[model samples]
Target chain A: MREVEPKLLKPLVAGFQLEKTLTKYIVSQHNFLYCQKAADLDASVGKTTFTLLRQINELQKILNQKIMLYRDRFSEADVYAVYCEHPDYEGLNDGTFVDRIEDMCELSTKCAIKEWNKSQIRNEAKQACFLFRERRKWLEIYKTIHNETKTVWLAQRHH
Target chain B: MSMPTIPPEPHRPNRKEVIIDLLESIALEEIALSHILNAESEKIQAFVGECLNFPTKPSSKEIIKFNKGVTQLLESVVMKEWILLRKLENVLDFEDDCEPHHKKCESRCHCSPCHSCHFPVCKCRCSHKKHKDHDCYPGK
Candidate 1:
């Protein structure tokens, strides 16, 4: 069996298109579901959430272009064939490159969602506080009215 | 059929519950990724070891080239990770908290970007002695 060519391996150094991986694993698989759920629950938050998602997507695209440009400065193939030249290369169990691209992307969304949830909670708490204050004021007014009516009824009974 | 009584209000999902779910998922992902990165690094290291271990040693030039390739691979990995981490931090609004300290600046200190460390300049006016010479002093 021909040993794994170093030339082929060299491409892998900077080769795996992370943008594509993130887009595939994150934007396509994860974000769509989250967006749908967020929108279903709340419209305003859903709009902001979509905006954040767009920013992330744009960031990925810009970085992808930058990395590609930087990578272009280097030659594609070089004389690094020593690994393949080893006699026992065939016996060597070169483990598979398990790209944890999904996990990383998932973490990104996890963080983004967490922030959104925090802001949502904050807004909810604020609104709840306002309602509580309003209700308290009404309760005080009702109590005063009840006290006046009771006093008038007692005087009438005494008379 | 007899007239039914008024139904109770539908249960609305609590914001805290959703936040808790998000936090849990984030924690789980971090733990999984930590292990995954370590495992992947080991695999790469093993490959590099095999490349170096030879019956008849190759020329110094070839060895250097192989090492260079390995370094480049590792560099790419680190860069990718850094990018993702920074992006994550940005998403979470944790950019103000610089690394090493990672503590919020209590005093009126502005965190300027230091080109050397790529981390923010730690002029947090904290107890940590100011390294004026190098704005991004990484060490304690």
Candidate 2:
């Protein structure tokens, strides 16, 4: 009944058309059969990279929120907390390391799970289209998450 | 410099086809965005356009200019390489056309002695050491 195509389909078509023009523009030759393979791979990689970063950014935001919640909850409390201010993560202190190691073990395990997630993403990303800078970025994100999560692991209330 | 796995040969889209598809997709994206942003004023819409971007957003004015410059240079290089390769091929073909097929130059070059030359294995085609591709003349 509608005169126009679906909104999603339109962008897809547009992306395809744009890819063509850009490839031709990038490769310049109508006869790009040889280099075309690499070029297409590169394009696909770029797309995948963009998607990966966005997902990572989403994850970062979630972590940011978690850290922030604690920041607000314990800002005025007597607890010792390590605060990451930029997109802040509020780390709290639960007595000290002299506390139950079982609780510490449990927390460490959770942080390990997050580490596993980061590696899984890297593995998938590399298979698709990994670049040095992008890889570096993933590392940075991982490190940020790892450090914060470790802090969270140490500071979170253990059951 | 992580290598993007070349999609297996069967799955890989042809460059021409990919290019055409990309162009269409790009146009569609712009039009879609245009409609999406039609409600907003030009200034805010422009910001919206930038915000909506992913790694590969559809075509924009800047890309057009960049494409033109890069495409022109790329086109020129590809054409030049093709022409040069073709010329080299023709010269070899001309040699082959000779009644006896370069028995004279054959002794002179001793191409078989060259480690890189494929001439020893395949007598007909001369993939000389200097050239990157299979197309080359057996420098007389």
Candidate 3:
């Protein structure tokens, strides 16, 4: 019975660790993308805008993957246990899962604005792209912190 | 210099009036953009209120779907206007140099009453004088 218990726990522990690693990676990548976008906005036209947007999309895909994995490995009951154990767990899970989602939404908004600015520039119209770029930066930070917080919440479930 | 010909009527459109009218038109576009954004924001606030009152369990799927729609709408209108405003600013930079011909008649004419018109109606020589006292121009 003792041997069986250890074996049973192995996969669960491994899965939990994998989730933590993935969450960290996603958060880091999100931050990197944001910084890149800001640098691009500061630079000359055409080069920075599209590149930054592509990076954002890539980071978003990675985040989605991690989120899916987290969902797949753990049942709602497991998540609820973590929520019950952690003091701030409810804060992390409630209202769209982290304040970061709101930040990302804001970033997505800025991306739309940036895209519009690009079109206007193509038409030879004068326009500022700074506002959108600024919002994107905030978004990147928000996503990173959000992922980290979720990962911590999950890790607490086991200990 | 040959005497300037006087119009039989008290209303005639002048070059200065036209420039002022153009400026007004441009200004109106900016105002329109702001109004549109304001209205959309109000709608979003109302939607949020409704969502808060909903008795059903909040589904992540539903929240995500609604969020996406709102993001798209903001992008389409508010973002587009921001870009347009930038382009308009550039146009203004160049047009500022030329002296307006209608500076003197701006008060008397209704053509450039606001920033929406680039051609001020000639109250001194134009034919549309007896129109109802509209916001700017009355008859024509």
Candidate 4:
């Protein structure tokens, strides 16, 4: 396995601070507005929003934990090996992070349909979409790092 | 006798228009950031793929090249993401500036009491034909 230096790995795990900003400015705004006007919405819409918000909150927690884990645990290891071994990264053979993004999108659409409140639903949907897109982008980065590191490992083995 | 000078009507941007402008700006900035990120990702992906062609045991030259590629990737992608967050924050801050102080009704007419007119029924001079026959008028 190719052991990359911590400094090199640092950038890969960078930008967790972004989640805080997004939550503060975007997600929380939607939440606050929804809470204020929720009484007027249909019961079904309220339930859906509740589920959607819960899902978002859970996803945020998981994402934050995963980023921190990556920063702390993989100080000096092959990116591929780490991904393969880490429970959070591997996700118990579940489909890649892309699958979770698809799930979120489905929920977002459902919430939007039920609520029909543009101010309450659309901004939250956008924030969720952007967050998942960011996560997926980072996943690609990890995979890229993994492929290169794998190549380096093979070359080192040969050497 | 000197003619009395008339001042230009002070421009009062519609609250909805102001909000829409801010939102459009935010959307444009987001699109720009997304494009920058995609380009940076492509650059890094290509560079990493190039690393595969290095010799079994990279010489000092190859090592230096690889390190430089890694550093550049970090600088480009991470910095761009940080800048995106800052820009988004600024745009969101502008939202407060556009928010109407008066409560808006839940209709598409986009009517609100005119702050300057101080009339209970003045719907901010909305041109909605539905309101044309309404008893309310500006300064009435």
> Between candidates 1 and 3, which one is better according to DockQ?
1
Q: What is the DockQ of each candidate?
A: 0.01, 0.05, 0.01, 0.01
Candidate 1 Cα outliers beyond 4 Å, as residue runs = A1-17, A27-39, A48-52, A69-71, A76-159, B1-140
State the lDDT of candidate 4 residue by residue for B1-140, as single tens digits.
99998787788666555544554553454445445544544543343343333224445455345434533443444455445445544544444333343334434344444445422234456454444555554435
Clashing pairs in 1: none
| Model 3 lDDT tens row, B13-61 | 6644544454455445544544554554454444444333323433545
lDDT string for model 2 (A103-157, tens) is 2222233332355544454454343222223422432443454435434553344
Clashes of each: 0, 23, 26, 0
**TM-score for each prediction?**
0.21, 0.17, 0.28, 0.29
| Candidate no. 4 TM-score | 0.29
Residue B68 in candidate 1, Cα distance off native in Å: 41
Give the worst 10-residue stretch by lDDT in candidate 3 chain B: B110-119
DockQ of 1: 0.01
The better candidate by TM-score, 2 or 4, is 4
* Superposition error at B38 for model 3 (Å): 2.1
Candidate 2 runs further than 4 Å off? A1-159, B41-140
How much native contact recovery, as a fraction, does model 4 achieve? 0.00
TM-score for predicted model 3 compared with the true structure = 0.28
lDDT of 2 by residue, B109-138 (tens): 443322443233224344544443323343
- Of models 1 and 4, which has the larger TM-score? 4
Docking class of 2: incorrect
What lDDT does candidate 4 reach at residue A112?
32
Worst 10 residues of 2 chain B by lDDT: B36-45
- Give the Cα-based TM-score of candidate 1 against the true structure: 0.21
Per-residue lDDT over A1-159 for candidate 4, one digit per residue giving the tens place of the 0 to 100 score: 224433333222223333323232222223322332332333433444444444454444445444544444443234443343333433322433334434434444544344454345556555655666666555556656544653456434433
For candidate 2, the TM-score is: 0.17
